[model samples]
Target: MARLQLRNLEKDYGGFKAVHGINLDVADGEFMVLVGPSGCAKSTTLRMIAGLERVTGGEIRIGDSLVNDKAPGERGIAMVFQNYALYPHMKVRKNLSFGLRLKRRPAEEIEQATRDVSNILEIGDYLERLPKQLSGGQAQRVAVGRALIKKPQVFLFDEPLSNLDAKLRASMRVRITDLHKQLKADGLQSTVVYVTHDQTEAMTMGDRICVMKEGRIMQVADPVTLYNRPANAFVAGFIGSPEMNLIDADLSGSTLSIGSQSLALGPAMLERLNPKAASALTFGVRPQHFSLVGAGEDNALEGRVSHVEFMGHEVYLYVNVEGQQMIVVVSATAYDRSKIQGDIVRLQPSQETAHLFDRKTGENVSLADLH
Candidate 1:
């Protein structure tokens, strides 16, 4: 568990920069996850930490040592790749002990390390089997066991569960979380940085998640902060399931209108608006925040439901209102299916929960004055 610091880090091939100058810190024993869409340079960042990719510029520090010039072996880091990267020819125990054997470690120590890792991973019974005979999850455990045998300072995982089936991936996620905790309890100085494009893994696994787009970080926050208070429109739209509903509207001196229809927020919410914002703005609301409110001036908007989807425990309904679309999630037991699609209804959002952003800048302006 080592503290890592990356300052003004960059990766370039000739004139093209794959990764811009990025700064980040990984606390000792912290589980940090880097997540982004394809071509966002998250995998590049993780590989740079593993010494698999050269740092075009900036310093890479593990604990107090600047390791920019160190080779992968010299940096004392073990990387678990997406493919599991196991040796098909070797038995599980042999694969697990390969690194130690390559380093010419003593027989007794190697045996003890292999035994301990297998026990920790609960793969002790499969040690004699070859990789070909093992299940996907078992093979992955062997891959992790290989890394553990080296007992390196840092662990880098790049979409390690991407190859597994849905059920296996879910199970492996829990195992990996438990494995991190188990490692920390042993007082090892290991820093972990996992890279994934999957939102569920990033949300469940990371102590801090760095959301990236176009090789730049949009926001780096814990899951709770991200879900409740997004930093920008992209982050808000990208981070949530089904995303937040964004609607264009008119903003006057003291009133907000969705075209001819007017809606209102609490005084506290209104006070946060830009004093000069009399032109227009965008209002955002999460699906779960919307509810039916009686029609009235400056209260709600009328909408005709277009579709409703039943997702077992809840309902997702799409409503078209005021030339815009809104998604609402309702309790399964409360919302009747028969009146879902054709009903003409008025919908309102809680005053405090509504998020308002500047139309041009897309910055959060709803609660700016209150803060």
Candidate 2:
């Protein structure tokens, strides 16, 4: 177990900066996830921490030791990659013990570590089977076991479940979370750094998420903090499911208008936004935030229904409002398509959950002023 710190971390190729200078402190026994779209330098950041990729300029400290110049094997970190990277011809047990054998550990000690890892990973029955004979999930477990046999100070996972089928990937997510819990209970002070493009993985597994964009860290926050209280337009759009509906907006006196509908921000919403925010703002509302308001000047939106998709759990209704496409999610059991057809639909951001951003800077003036 180790406390990992990346100080002013930067990575560059020739003159192209892949990751700009950024700082993060991962507590001992913490699970931190790095998430973003491709070209965000998440993999490069992970490799740098593991000493597989050299830092362009910065310091990487594991526990009390500064290991910026250490070799990959000397970094005391284990990396589990997307490809599994298991030897097809080697048995699972042999694969797990390969590193120990290379290090010249005693045969008995290597055998014990191999047995312990296999047992913890629940692959004891497949110990004699080769990678060719194992299922995708089993192969990934073997890969994890191989990393565990080394017992490194930190665990690094780079999209480890990307190769598996969707169901297996979902199952592995739970298994990995359970594994972290068990390992912590056993007194291993391990730090985990996981990198993935999947928002679901980022929201579920991390103690803190580092949201990246174009080589810069946009925001570092807990799942709910990043979701309910985003720092910018990019972070808001990147983290949520179905994404938030962003429309060109203006605030006139006390009313916030998006397209043709005027939203009653009321005293609650007004107190939430910038005091000076009276005009020229962007209205950001999540799909689940919209509600059918009563007739008259109350919450209402006139739109044309473009399409509808039934998702078993809920229904997604796509409507064209003010020349913008807006999607709304509703319980399939509560309301059928007949209730939300060509009639003038009324929608409001229930409980004042909508977000407002600056038209130019994209800064979350609404949230920033409140804090």
Best by the TM-score measure: 2
Q: On a 0 to 100 scale, what is the lDDT of residue 369 in model 2? A: 56
Q: Estimate the TM-score for candidate 2.
A: 0.95
After superposition, candidate 1 runs with Cα above 4 Å error: 271-280, 294-298, 336-341, 367-371
Q: Highest lDDT, which number? A: 2
Q: Write the per-residue lDDT of candidate 2 for residues 49-74, one digit (tens) a residue.
A: 98988888989999889999999899
Which residue pairs in model 2 clash with each other? Answer: 1-189, 1-190
- Worst-scoring 10-residue span by lDDT in model 2: 335-344
Measured against the true structure, the TM-scores of the candidates, in listed sequence, are 0.92, 0.95
lDDT string for model 1 (1-371, tens) is 38988998999979989888898988999989999888999999988888889999998999889999899998878999998899898999899999999999999999999999999999999999999999999999999889988988889899999999999999999999889998899897557899998888988998899988776788888998877777766677777788899889877766778867887656967766656553667888898887765444247778888887999888887988888999988888867544433488667776677777778876677656334
The whole-model lDDT of each prediction reads 0.84, 0.85
